[model samples]
Target: MAANEKIKEKISHLPHKPGIYKFFDENGIIYVGKAVDIRKRVSSYFNRSAQHNKKTLKLISQIQDIEFTIVDTEADAFLLENNLIKQYQPKYNILLKDGKTYPYICIVNERFPRIISTRNKINDGSRYFGPYASVTTMNVVLDLIRTLYPIRTCTYNLSPENVDAGKFKVCLEYHIGNCKGPCENLIDETTYNQNITQIRSILSGNLSVAKNYFKERMAAAAEEYQFEVAHQYKQKLDLLDDFQAKSTVVSNTLSNIDVFTITSNDKCSFINYLKVMNGSIILTQSLEVQKKLDETDEELLATVIVQLRHEFESTSREVITNIELQLPLDNVTVTYPQIGDKRKLLNLSLKNAMYLRKEREGRQEKNKDLSEQREIRVLETLKKDLRLTELPRQIECFDNSNFQGDNPVASMVCFKNGKPSKKDYRHFNIKTVVGPNDFESMYEIVTRRYKRLLEEKQPLPQLVIIDGGKGQLSFAVKALKDLDLWGKIAIVGIAKRLEEIFYPGDTLPLYIDKKSESLKLIQRLRNEAHRFAITFHRSKRDAGTLKTELTEVKGIGLSTAESLLAKFRSVKKLRELSQDELAQEIGQRKASILYNYFHNVA
Candidate 1:
């Protein structure tokens, strides 16, 4: 839990106020969080806590710098956190599952406006409302608006001058009574504007204006003894009533509130949100938050609350949840209801979250089963192709590497169930082999690997692969024979020139199909072994070169040479230092000997 001194210094100076904090590594920001007290929240990560998961520990290990922006209130912190996450998309933050935007009802700004549903929100002067979670609901709203008010549905540019010059004609919409023919000036500007105003009220969740208008019109028609006109008004009023009834899923008393509930497993959390306005549930959405730090349900719920509210432009002052939260939301009431309509709303949201969680778990389990079956099938194919008594479930490949007869090394890579078993991979330093003898190096490494396994009474591999032709395979077989494991393990050698496979006693090569799964698996093992051996050889060669250069100085032992190289990193850099500078690192006596040796001075 102890962070480096640099991180500790930053943590000590964090201000005790509301803010958004970002954790950055050498690459970029890795995590972002909101906190009522920045100092306490950031310090919690470095404290000894059993609750920290492996992901959080890794994030803490990579943090190079901490940045924070002070805000006026916790609500401001929440908003800033949401904005920063959307901007940076940090690796350790919960992201919305889908990137699709919800639908909004846009009232286009023009001489005669048209009401339409869109997923994009432009920054023009037009008014947009209802980012409805369901497009069907949005379409229902649009249809009702069209039925109640005969506004224009066409894309005609109905400017004052265009209408006066008779640039447009009445379309079929006007003849069918769906439009007021605003393009042909059949409806006056003031009258068309009155309909737009009432439509705006309906979109804003205030149906009282439209309902009252229809009631007044119906009364006027009835007073004149015109039953047909009055019946039309009655039908319009019933439409409004029916829409309200469907939207108001809970009590009519709940207005301008948000209800949230969360269900989580060890790896992810599902959050469901219900947005209520004017005593009606206008929006309901469920989101999947991929867990990065094994965050508690309360912490995840808080994040979702801020994100969903900002995305949907919710202005609710009250929030109901299934679990209590300790967040400091400015001018907002957090309630956990026990027994009421609000409790029922919370239960409904929780059910949605649970359903999403179950669906995700089932999908993951199915994927896992499919992966296991595929691995088994590949292993079975490999077993039949090689004609082995038992399945080659555990296979090991050996490779030798050297640089022009210098610093020879070998590597052994293991594969289990047709996949690389990195934990069992071993590197050898070519013990008992002189110069660049590939055959002896392979034999020595093969003997040393299994002799130790035999000594430890560990299980042996079912198959062994050598990355060379008959010469290398013969030596490996001899080593196995000497250890009484010659016929026990199925061994083969693959040559690089023609990709030929050779048996222990067989002279001619056994060439499997080029596209066969068995051949591909063998190629993968050989490539991995070669790569591992080359990497180990390069590192050893580099270290030896650095050591030999410094150790050439008279009276300089391996320990001093290693110490110097560790401090200066390279002999080339060591040569650039003056005797005085060298003396500061080693004593003046050894420093003089090393300096004169490098400078060729007496």
Candidate 2:
């Protein structure tokens, strides 16, 4: 556990500021927690005298290590913690985490760059814009860009060298006049590049140059009595205007503004984000975030803003919302526009948020019904195969993760009606066995799990799966028998080598049908447990790399080092701070000690 001298040294330096903290074992992130005072919150775990419930004790027992990130305020802490929990999905949290990949407009990184809509963003020196909330809006914009510019839309390498060698040919796009014959070098590279420059500027919300350039050309053609050329420009200008009209709800004064509004129900929260470029709503979409920790409206909204912008690849610095909150970010402004176009955009965002909320709820209800039917089928199949009295709607599988007796850990994954019961999944530190003894670890964890359940009078799973061959299964059965729960729960041991199922006291193993849903469910549960355990193990190994960096600073005793770690969390951050800043937290004397250590000016 982190109560060891090294980890305690790390804990003492935890920042007193609000932040998110994670507990890890060899397997992975076991628990993630948010605290207003990270130092105090972390210190509580190691404080021996503190009263702990069974669950807290279970969590604390396995924490071989810890890590944390400091945020500016409590609100930031809440938001960051929620995001981390969703990302890492530590075993202890019950999260309503949901995510979807949105689409982006990529200007391909190539000679004669091709513009297209893609969900994948790879940085190969290509310019990428927008995870457009609406595919319709993105397509519409793409259409306008195509219509306005005779840029190549085809997937051709229009390199000058290739064109000179006559290695490529123009296709239907060139025949239809939708693209200049850049592939044939009929249009010079410099001339085609000029069109690309204007397209780039227009996409970035600066359309004045493009609009003026087209208008000036149109006027020049008409004055020269070239009516066809003038008419063509007029048509392109009109098409551009039509595309802008779809997005433009308000006047052009409010440009490059990101409008955000939040709406919520009991189950989930929705955030609508609208990016106004050149006073047009270039991007409009509402995102849904599942609320797990009962975070406030302000906190949700703030958190959603950070997530959506990053996910959607939005860069608009001027953010407008229906309500105001401290953004606590640099070079970004958060405002509540009460009137005029800004307010109108805000209302539009709110409307989208509300509509999306209702839409999502309807879809979820429909899915719940379908899921219920599917689960019933799977559970019924499991019940018959296991010969259980009740439906095996709840199942649990256990697995241990260890590599050469380093950071040994165990995990249990739960399934409810054949679906992952994520909130019920658990990870355990092997308390009784020091080395890689999977059998003893299994016995200890099984006993602990059932005993704790009995104490709390909680509902036990109908099925308990031991992820091992015969020997490990026997150990688990003994533990269950000791707890007087052997027959109450229908337990089975799954042998990984042959996928054979063994019942207690049965020498002959049950070979389930390879195609059976029951077998698949068991495999999934076992795999999930193994995955959970291995992930924790890797995180523990990674944290070990940073352990030795802090031991060298003089005047920093073990307690002082731990205190510094509890406050700073990172040696790099401590080294980066000025003596005055360091003095404010630690005393002036220690601050000088740290400053001199990093600088070593003598």
Candidate 1 local lDDT, 264-283, one digit each (tens) = 88888888999877878788
**Clash-forming residue pairs, model 1:** none
Tell me the TM-score of each prediction against the true structure: 0.84, 0.54
lDDT tens readout by residue for model 2, 123-213: 6988887777678877877878887888777776767688889998888888988877877877877777788888888788777778888
Strongest candidate by TM-score: 1
User: What TM-score does prediction 2 earn?
Assistant: 0.54
Model 2 bad stretches (over 4 Å): 1-15, 24-27, 30-36, 40-87, 91-101, 362-602
RMSD of each: 4.6, 13.2
